[model samples]
Target: MSTNTPAPVGSSGKGASLARMGVFTLAMINVSAIVSLRGLPAEATYGLSSAFYYIFAAIFFLIPVSLVAAELTTGWPQKGGVFRWVGEAFGTRLGFLAIWLQWIESTIWFPTVLTFAAVSLAFIGPDQRWDEAVSANKWYVLAIVLAVYWSATLLNFKGMRTSAGITKWGTMIGTVIPGALLIVFGLIYWGSGNKVDINMAPGNFFPDLTNFNNIVLAASIFLFYAGMEMSAVHVKDVKNPGRNYPMAILIASLITVGIFVLGTLAIGYIIPEAQINLVQSLLIAFDKFFTIFHITWLGPVMAVCLACGVLAQVVAWVGGPSKGLLQVGYAGYLPRAMQKTNKKGVQTGILFIQGGIVTILSVMFVIMPSVQSAYQIISQLTIILYLIMYMLMFAAGIALRHKEPNVPRTFRIPGGKHFGMWLVAGVGLLGSVIAFLFSFVPPDQISVGSPTLYVVILLLGAVIFAGIPFLIYAMKKPSWKNTDSANEFEPFNWELKKTNTETSAPAPEQQH
Candidate 1:
């Protein structure tokens, strides 16, 4: 969270110490927080080239985000995670946009993720045809998405301990175990005499760079590596903040990339590229693998695990951004209503409003032709907004290096102070720019119904969603400050400087 705490994700307190924490535990937490089977099928469509995208995204985007965010977190160390980081570099308004994009992207992300859970739930039965048909039904998907999302949202009202349990168990059972099984099953199938579906030639390792639509879909692969920024705060938890921190991050990166690359290859090896259905292909691949091994009952069990994982992920994410938004609201960016919390200090008003937005966006399932297409459309929009936020975050990192060079960061990006910042943040910014531009182009891989409507959804969603924050920032009143005595959000450094300069200024006669 922009608030710079893990409690929003899993922990109920600030963080733990090296006595109870180690490199491996931190690495696995990064793995479980980030690794998801829902996205394997999308990358699998690229066959051997999927490995390239995953590695590329990790180097240019994933590692840089964690590194840059770590620097920003230490430098600013303010309550508003992104809001504090960006506002310190730019101003409160752009800072507001940064946090808004994060919150909105996550809100839009729920239904798409839950769509996978819906499909997982639908495919829990042994009959493939019936399961596929049911998963494709928009109404069924919608009902499951709403029901499950609402359940997670409601559970959030109970506070962090409840969701933490769901996230912990869900990540292991749903993601880790299933991901291992997928790779093992693929190796087993390959070890036996089973035929491979995708081309294994070295030439197939690189995608057609000229194909704009191909890159458009591949742009989404950047997001698959998202959410590792949480690891940055753990730098202090390990023995050597310098050595062990980067090592843990590197190990986690390798593990995360390994799971993604191997898992994607596993799916592509079995399912023909043409037969890949974003919503159903993962479940189908599992069932196919089980059928080959003559143990078909595990298909439903895998679905249950995957569905639970997605649901648990929803529970984990439900309140994080909203809480950041809530903190910002307390600082006077949002209405009093949105700033309200329940007895548990949960951001109920914002959560309820987020749920409403999700309910509306979930309708895209019906408006688009198929579940995959709808998923693709919404996903494209999510990437665009998120990439914009990333671009701002990256640029903010660079800007602050120049603007506040003496701020005494606990961790630096490594190289020279300024040059290293440039190298890392620049790469992240460039990658984000490329992906941001490509997100507007509709992918040829999925049927998005109307290209015009698809573009409209992307353009309008980006413009309107990004535009809303400035409107709220402009509308904020001085009286909007946090009413709570204990949790008064800190003012931005610029805000304090402006006050100081004003205080030191002379009267008109005195100045003359």
Candidate 2:
């Protein structure tokens, strides 16, 4: 039986430790990585039916991704996350595409989340209208987004310890505490005999699936769960990965889903369906709850927390996918200039390039017809790019099952061999494809201007971003690899097999 040995956690010999992370720490990392409370109000617009979307997405996308990623991570506990896994199944070219999508999607995603953070910061003011004015000011939002994102990028340049510390504390202060408080206040509102705005009728639990446009916003829920697979990259860092990894995933998934469901319901219970604002409702709900509970001062406090949470999230992601792509670059897929690292061993070249893309995307606030339109366009594009990568990942999981069946997996997905792999990865792929298709059908909730223009931009963005990696792969030169780099990304298993086959074959008639 063949087994891929796990690499040391802090393998870079720069005083990094090999200490393993505990299950709780790993679970919190997953929660911090996955949960974002800002999007709850948008989902809350569906009333009680929002529960159905949350649960449906969790089943079809969340659990399957977590489990499948756990198996893949444990099977090959290397540096590159999706890039390493997918490349092993397909080849280096497509593998580079997978990591590229991961990095670039997050690059596009920064502006959207930062927009939420900008709105959150605006709400810190006492006057609602003034806050709304600030939030709506495109230049104001653009300036704050660039400032916060660049700050996070600079902090990340220091190294992982600094980045991870911010992510941990930021999650607790910004996400977990605020989420729990929202749920608590929701319970108080219901228990205090207050009239709930949402329909609690059992019949309303399921969403209207007949109207495709009605469910378009629900498609965004898939993006809410996007970063869970990212946490899987750390599976090998946890002690007893085979046993503890699943435990961590289970705990994290339950916590993540609970926060999402109850948080959305909390907003639905307070804000009327028609009045829910995609960016403002979350804060407004907090304000309303605080007012009723006679703790109105907490509103601004929660706003600060949410803004910090957004920064922490950006901090965590700013370092993650880029680091993976850096590994891909070292594997000869990217030009050597892109592979340069700082003295801190951080990917300086890639970080700067990523920041440049972010700056350009942030500028869309001025060019797009409205701030909301810009938000929707970039958000939809992010969803499409990420879903494309996910499709490749799901397909890779199943392909690896056939190609490397004998490779021992410490945390195999439950069920018979082929059935387990197929069932888990298949559901994830189907959900991703469905979400990808619906993302093109402009959301009914927002004013995205021209529907034709929206579709064209999404298609064009998807093709262009997805095509760039292939272009780089075709243009790759042997000199693009940095031999001086201490960390050497492993060759794909197929490449090794082909090499072994050729080496063992009889020499060409010796040309004697």
Candidate 3:
């Protein structure tokens, strides 16, 4: 059976032992990697019905991703995460596409998220009008987005130890503590016979599924669950990955789902449906929730915590995919120049490239009609790119079950092997395809510029970004491989088999 012998180039030493992460630490990393509070207010528009959408998405997308990823990571805990998994199933060609999509989607998404973070920063003041005006200023938004993103990238460059430390505390203070507090305050408000805006009647618990626009909004919840697989890249750094990693995924999924579901309900309980503006409603809800407890002073404090949570989440993202690309770089997929790593084994080169992409995309704030327009347009592309990657991941999961049946796995999908793999990965793949389709239909609420132009941009972005990896693969040369001491990678099952099919010869010399 094949084994995932941990590599030395993980965090700080020449041994995997250097970066020993416990279940709690790994779980926190997973949590911070995916959760963001920006979309809760949008979901709050559905009132108590939002819970139905959250639970639906968790079943079809979130849980499937967690299960498939657990099986894939435990069976093949290589450095490249999705790159390694897909490559094993198909070939290096598509695998590079998978990893690049992971990188580029996050690249495209930086602005949307940082814009939210910028708004969070804007709210760190007493006056709502001032906060609204500051958030709308192009210059203020651009500066905050660049500054915060670059700071997170730089923090990740310090390697896993420093990054993980900040992630743990940041997620706790920013997300978990604040989320718990909001839910608690919401309950208090409801208990005190406060005027709740949403009807708690059982009949209002489900959204109108016949409405296409509602599905468009609900489909976005899929992307909220997107980054779980990225955390698989860190399995090697964890303690007893076979045992602890799967458990961590379950723990993180629960925390994230709870925050998203209950947090949205908190907002719905406080704010009237007619007044819910996606941009300001969350802060507005927080303010009213604070007022209920007679602690309106804590409004700005909550804003700061939300910003910290975003920064922590960005740090998690900044590390995972870039490191995965670095692994593929050593295998000759990326240019040798981009394969460099620091003393702490962080991929500084790729981070710079990633930062450069963000810098360019951030310029759209000034180029577009407004920051909101830029975010609305660019975010569609982000969803498209990421759903494509997810589709590939789900396909790879099912393929690997048959293609490498003998490979030892610490965790497998429930039920039997083949049937379980088909069921879980099939559900994930179907969900991704559905989300990908729903992404094109522009929401009825927002004036996303010209709808035709918006759809054109999304289609064109998908084609262009998806094609770049293929171009890279075609242009690759043996000389592109990094020969440095830390660049060693294991041969895939398919690569080994192809080698044996050729002339009977000694194995290819280990390429580092």
Q: Write the per-residue lDDT of candidate 3 for residues 1-512, one digit (tens) a residue.
A: 00001112246545555256788877777776667677787778788888888878777888788778878887898668888899899888999999999888877887877787888889999997888889888899899999988998888878777777666677677766777887788878788888888999999888888888877766677777776665565665666665676688778778877888878988988888777766667777888877767988999999998888777767766776677788888988988778777888888888898899899889988877777767777777888888898899999999998889989876667668699889989988998899899888877766667888778877888999899999999999999887776678888878888888886876789889
Candidate 3 lDDT at 61 equals 86
Off by over 4 Å in 3: 1-33, 155-164, 231-255, 342-345, 505-512
Instruction: Give the winner by lDDT.
Output: 1
Question: Per-residue lDDT of 191-262 in model 2, one digit per residue for the tens?
Answer: 888999999999999777887777897888898887677557676565577678778887877888888899
Pick the winner on TM-score between candidates 1 and 2: 1
**Candidate achieving higher lDDT, 1 or 2:** 1
Against the hidden true structure, what lDDT does model 1 obtain? Answer: 0.84
Question: CA shift at 399, candidate 2, in angstroms?
Answer: 0.8
TM-score of each: 0.95, 0.92, 0.87
* TM-score for predicted model 1 compared with the true structure: 0.95
lDDT of 2 at 478: 89
* Candidate number with the higher TM-score (2 or 3): 2
C-alpha root-mean-square deviation, each candidate: 2.7, 4.3, 5.7
lDDT string, candidate 1, 390-484, tens digits? 88899999999998888877777888868999999999999989888888888888888888988988899999999988888888887878777
Give the C-alpha miss distance for residue 251 in model 3, angstroms: 6.0
